[model samples]
Target: MTAHQLLGSDRHRDLRVRAERGAALGDAVMTSLVVPAEFRRVQDEYPILFRMNQERTDFVALALFGFENGENLFLKGDRWDARYRPLALAIQPFLIGHAAPDSDVRQVHVDTASPRISGDGEGIRVFDGDGRPTPYLEEVAELLGELDAGYRESAAFFAALRQHNLLEPFTLEIELDDGSINRLVGYHAIDEQKLAALGPDALGALHGEGHLMPIFMAVASLGRIAELVARKNQRNADG
Candidate 1:
């Protein structure tokens, strides 16, 4: 059974994390979160696209890893081959949760089923013998703080995208080396035409809100698709 409990020095003091990377640790995915705060870092390593939520009320930026489902081409021998790891994938089994059902107080929780976590003393200790958090735990706290802030920033960033009509549904046509053509649908990206048509006042509003740079960054990120295609071809050839 999967359970998430509040971290405590007494209860989780002996816990350790093996810290594996890639699919073995559940990193296999076609897309994951891309925070506006990390847009510059993500654009160089992966293709950035936007996808509508299931409710269709909003969109979320995604860092595309592969052309197909369950295909993270960035994974190589259980190691991620990227300089900057997306915050959504960098931290696993750890999240900030409320202390109570209606409480506003945030606390850290972990997924007990995660393979990265252990009680066999094989990974970084959760706490020191004096019942204080270890450096690993401290780092986890910092990561959670950053991830939380990034997502909050995204809420406003995506809202701005929607308000400006800057997003459009997109489809990707992929032709693999093995003589198969595939199409990816149901995602969105910046509509350059609409963006260009915006009046100066509107553009100034976006710029003042700190959305201009990330917008151009996301647009420029389309170039990374060539790199992804090349990697896919290499993987196919190696098989």
Candidate 2:
């Protein structure tokens, strides 16, 4: 079970967070959920796709990191090889959440059980001795604020996609060098043919509403599938 606590100076003044990546610290993953606000940068680094949320009410935009679950091809040794790491990964061990109804501000919470947390200066400090936010904590607050705003924007973006009947599901099959096949089923990506078929009026609406860029970025990201394939092959060859 996860033991997440509301991060505060009073109770966690001794808190230290390590801003590093390691497979032993649960860094392995197939994908990270992304937001429309980051589509431009994220598309350049990973294949962008949409997965059905557990509730099936909204589609989650994802940056593909590996062909299968519990694996991340971008992670080599203790470092992430890609030039860009998704915001979702950068904000690990800390999450933005609400504390109660009628609360107007989002609060930051930490998973105390996370392997990254230490008391002996193993990581970033949450607060100084005077119970004040440190530079690192301030940056986290800003990032969390941006993430919250992005989520709100994404809700509207998904609504627009559904309104245009553009959401569709497809399967992807990956062949590894070791003669095993990895097939991803039930995931969805934007349909380019249908997108191109949109009427000028509809296209204009997407453009006017700032949705066209993300749509194109999502489609352009498909080109990165080959890059991921190469990484998987290299990993296999090295083994």
Which prediction has the highest TM-score against the true structure?
A: 2
| C-alpha lDDT values of all predictions | 0.85, 0.88
The digit string of per-residue lDDT tens for model 2 on 44-89 reads 8999999889998889999999888888999997998888888887
Give each prediction's root-mean-square deviation over alpha carbons: 1.6, 1.4
Q: lDDT for model 2, please.
A: 0.88
At residue 148, candidate 1 shows an lDDT of 84
Candidate 2 runs further than 4 Å off? none
In model 1, which runs have C-alpha deviations exceeding 4 angstroms? none
The sequence of per-residue lDDT tens digits that candidate 1 reaches over residues 117-204 is: 8767787787899999888788888888888888878888988898989999889998888877767798888999999999999999
Clashes of each: 0, 1
TM-score of each: 0.94, 0.95
lDDT of 2 at 131: 96
What's the distance in Å from true for residue 113, model 2?
1.9
